[model samples]
Target: MALLSHDAGGKPVRAASGANATLYCNESTAGLSMLHKELAQLDERVQRLIAAYRQARLERKRALQERDRLLALNAELKRRIEGVVERIRLLESDQAQ
Candidate 1:
Protein backbone atom coordinates (compact mmCIF):
# COMPACT_ATOMS: atom_id res chain seq x y z
CA MET A 1 0.00 0.00 0.00
CA ALA A 2 1.14 3.63 -0.53
CA LEU A 3 1.08 6.53 1.89
CA LEU A 4 -0.80 9.65 0.75
CA SER A 5 -0.31 13.00 2.42
CA HIS A 6 -0.29 16.70 1.67
CA ASP A 7 3.02 18.52 1.71
CA ALA A 8 3.52 22.05 3.01
CA GLY A 9 2.53 23.40 -0.37
CA GLY A 10 -0.89 21.72 -0.11
CA LYS A 11 0.00 19.27 -2.89
CA PRO A 12 -0.65 15.60 -2.34
CA VAL A 13 2.55 13.58 -2.09
CA ARG A 14 2.82 9.83 -2.47
CA ALA A 15 5.07 7.60 -0.39
CA ALA A 16 6.07 4.35 -2.07
CA SER A 17 8.11 1.25 -1.25
CA GLY A 18 11.89 1.63 -1.56
CA ALA A 19 12.79 -0.28 -4.74
CA ASN A 20 9.54 0.52 -6.52
CA ALA A 21 9.86 4.17 -5.51
CA THR A 22 13.35 4.40 -6.94
CA LEU A 23 12.22 2.93 -10.29
CA TYR A 24 9.19 5.20 -10.41
CA CYS A 25 11.28 8.29 -9.57
CA ASN A 26 13.76 7.50 -12.32
CA GLU A 27 11.02 6.97 -14.88
CA SER A 28 9.27 10.21 -13.86
CA THR A 29 12.50 12.17 -14.17
CA ALA A 30 13.17 10.70 -17.62
CA GLY A 31 9.63 11.51 -18.75
CA LEU A 32 9.97 15.10 -17.50
CA SER A 33 13.29 15.51 -19.33
CA MET A 34 11.77 14.20 -22.55
CA LEU A 35 8.83 16.60 -22.14
CA HIS A 36 11.22 19.52 -21.68
CA LYS A 37 13.13 18.59 -24.82
CA GLU A 38 9.93 18.28 -26.84
CA LEU A 39 8.73 21.67 -25.61
CA ALA A 40 12.04 23.24 -26.60
CA GLN A 41 11.70 21.80 -30.08
CA LEU A 42 8.17 23.16 -30.36
CA ASP A 43 9.37 26.58 -29.28
CA GLU A 44 12.04 26.55 -31.96
CA ARG A 45 9.49 25.60 -34.60
CA VAL A 46 7.18 28.41 -33.51
CA GLN A 47 10.00 30.93 -33.78
CA ARG A 48 10.86 29.76 -37.27
CA LEU A 49 7.22 30.02 -38.34
CA ILE A 50 7.03 33.56 -36.97
CA ALA A 51 10.15 34.54 -38.88
CA ALA A 52 8.77 33.04 -42.09
CA TYR A 53 5.48 34.90 -41.62
CA ARG A 54 7.29 38.19 -41.22
CA GLN A 55 9.42 37.56 -44.27
CA ALA A 56 6.37 36.67 -46.36
CA ARG A 57 4.59 39.83 -45.24
CA LEU A 58 7.58 41.95 -46.19
CA GLU A 59 7.80 40.28 -49.58
CA ARG A 60 4.10 40.88 -50.19
CA LYS A 61 4.47 44.55 -49.32
CA ARG A 62 7.42 44.92 -51.67
CA ALA A 63 5.50 43.24 -54.49
CA LEU A 64 2.56 45.60 -53.96
CA GLN A 65 4.83 48.63 -54.09
CA GLU A 66 6.47 47.36 -57.26
CA ARG A 67 3.08 46.79 -58.87
CA ASP A 68 1.95 50.32 -58.00
CA ARG A 69 5.13 51.77 -59.47
CA LEU A 70 4.72 49.75 -62.65
CA LEU A 71 1.09 50.85 -62.99
CA ALA A 72 2.04 54.51 -62.62
CA LEU A 73 4.81 54.13 -65.18
CA ASN A 74 2.39 52.50 -67.63
CA ALA A 75 -0.06 55.41 -67.23
CA GLU A 76 2.70 57.93 -67.83
CA LEU A 77 3.78 56.09 -70.99
CA LYS A 78 0.21 56.05 -72.29
CA ARG A 79 -0.16 59.80 -71.75
CA ARG A 80 3.09 60.49 -73.58
CA ILE A 81 2.03 58.31 -76.49
CA GLU A 82 -1.30 60.18 -76.76
CA GLY A 83 0.53 63.52 -76.85
CA VAL A 84 2.80 62.27 -79.64
CA VAL A 85 -0.16 61.01 -81.69
CA GLU A 86 -1.89 64.40 -81.31
CA ARG A 87 1.23 66.19 -82.56
CA ILE A 88 1.52 63.84 -85.54
CA ARG A 89 -2.15 64.43 -86.42
CA LEU A 90 -1.64 68.20 -86.35
CA LEU A 91 1.49 67.96 -88.55
CA GLU A 92 -0.28 65.75 -91.08
CA SER A 93 -3.21 68.18 -91.30
CA ASP A 94 -0.85 71.13 -91.88
CA GLN A 95 0.85 69.21 -94.67
CA ALA A 96 -2.47 68.28 -96.26
CA GLN A 97 -3.60 71.94 -96.14
Candidate 2:
Protein backbone atom coordinates (compact mmCIF):
# COMPACT_ATOMS: atom_id res chain seq x y z
CA MET A 1 0.00 0.00 0.00
CA ALA A 2 2.96 2.40 0.46
CA LEU A 3 6.63 2.91 -0.35
CA LEU A 4 9.45 2.82 2.16
CA SER A 5 12.97 4.23 1.96
CA HIS A 6 15.87 4.97 4.22
CA ASP A 7 18.20 7.85 4.79
CA ALA A 8 21.82 7.71 5.84
CA GLY A 9 20.68 7.13 9.43
CA GLY A 10 18.63 4.05 8.42
CA LYS A 11 15.40 5.64 9.61
CA PRO A 12 12.38 4.26 7.82
CA VAL A 13 10.70 6.89 5.68
CA ARG A 14 7.21 6.16 4.49
CA ALA A 15 5.68 7.64 1.37
CA ALA A 16 2.49 7.28 -0.59
CA SER A 17 3.16 5.19 -3.69
CA GLY A 18 0.14 6.45 -5.64
CA ALA A 19 1.09 10.11 -5.10
CA ASN A 20 4.78 9.47 -5.84
CA ALA A 21 5.66 11.42 -2.75
CA THR A 22 8.81 10.75 -0.71
CA LEU A 23 10.24 12.08 2.49
CA TYR A 24 13.49 13.91 1.85
CA CYS A 25 15.67 13.28 4.81
CA ASN A 26 18.96 14.98 5.48
CA GLU A 27 20.68 12.93 8.15
CA SER A 28 22.53 15.97 9.37
CA THR A 29 19.59 18.04 10.75
CA ALA A 30 16.24 16.30 10.11
CA GLY A 31 15.66 15.49 13.76
CA LEU A 32 16.47 18.99 14.94
CA SER A 33 14.21 20.62 12.36
CA MET A 34 11.37 18.21 13.11
CA LEU A 35 11.73 18.94 16.80
CA HIS A 36 11.52 22.67 16.20
CA LYS A 37 8.46 22.26 13.98
CA GLU A 38 6.73 20.14 16.64
CA LEU A 39 7.53 22.74 19.28
CA ALA A 40 6.04 25.49 17.14
CA GLN A 41 2.85 23.47 16.64
CA LEU A 42 2.56 22.87 20.37
CA ASP A 43 2.95 26.55 21.14
CA GLU A 44 0.23 27.44 18.66
CA ARG A 45 -2.11 24.89 20.21
CA VAL A 46 -1.48 26.22 23.71
CA GLN A 47 -2.24 29.76 22.56
CA ARG A 48 -5.56 28.67 21.08
CA LEU A 49 -6.49 26.91 24.31
CA ILE A 50 -5.70 30.03 26.33
CA ALA A 51 -7.87 32.17 24.09
CA ALA A 52 -10.75 29.71 24.40
CA TYR A 53 -10.42 29.69 28.17
CA ARG A 54 -10.58 33.48 28.30
CA GLN A 55 -13.70 33.53 26.09
CA ALA A 56 -15.38 30.93 28.30
CA ARG A 57 -14.65 32.97 31.39
CA LEU A 58 -16.24 36.03 29.83
CA GLU A 59 -19.35 34.10 28.79
CA ARG A 60 -19.69 32.58 32.25
CA LYS A 61 -19.51 35.98 33.89
CA ARG A 62 -22.26 37.29 31.63
CA ALA A 63 -24.42 34.22 32.37
CA LEU A 64 -24.02 34.68 36.11
CA GLN A 65 -25.04 38.31 35.87
CA GLU A 66 -28.16 37.37 33.92
CA ARG A 67 -29.03 34.75 36.53
CA ASP A 68 -28.74 37.27 39.33
CA ARG A 69 -31.02 39.69 37.52
CA LEU A 70 -33.60 36.94 36.98
CA LEU A 71 -33.47 36.03 40.69
CA ALA A 72 -34.13 39.64 41.66
CA LEU A 73 -37.07 39.77 39.25
CA ASN A 74 -38.44 36.53 40.73
CA ALA A 75 -38.26 37.97 44.23
CA GLU A 76 -40.12 41.08 43.17
CA LEU A 77 -42.92 39.08 41.53
CA LYS A 78 -43.26 36.91 44.61
CA ARG A 79 -43.65 39.99 46.80
CA ARG A 80 -46.39 41.39 44.56
CA ILE A 81 -48.27 38.07 44.55
CA GLU A 82 -48.12 37.87 48.36
CA GLY A 83 -49.56 41.36 48.64
CA VAL A 84 -52.47 40.41 46.38
CA VAL A 85 -53.19 37.27 48.41
CA GLU A 86 -53.21 39.24 51.64
CA ARG A 87 -55.76 41.69 50.20
CA ILE A 88 -57.98 38.81 49.12
CA ARG A 89 -57.88 37.37 52.64
CA LEU A 90 -58.82 40.71 54.17
CA LEU A 91 -61.78 41.07 51.79
CA GLU A 92 -63.01 37.58 52.64
CA SER A 93 -62.90 38.27 56.37
CA ASP A 94 -64.81 41.53 55.96
CA GLN A 95 -67.50 39.75 53.92
CA ALA A 96 -67.88 37.12 56.59
CA GLN A 97 -68.33 39.75 59.30
Using TM-score, give the best candidate's number.
Answer: 1
Cα-based lDDT at residue 33, candidate 2: 80
lDDT of 2 by residue, 10-41 (tens): 98756654434433334325776887999999
Give candidate 1 regions above 4 Å deviation: 1-15
Report the C-alpha lDDT of model 1 over 39-94, residue by residue, as the tens digit.
99999999999999999999999999999999999999999999999999999999
**Which ten residues in a row are the worst by lDDT in model 2?**
19-28
Clashes of 1: 0
RMSD values for the candidates in order, in angstroms, are 4.3, 9.1
Q: lDDT of each structure? A: 0.88, 0.80
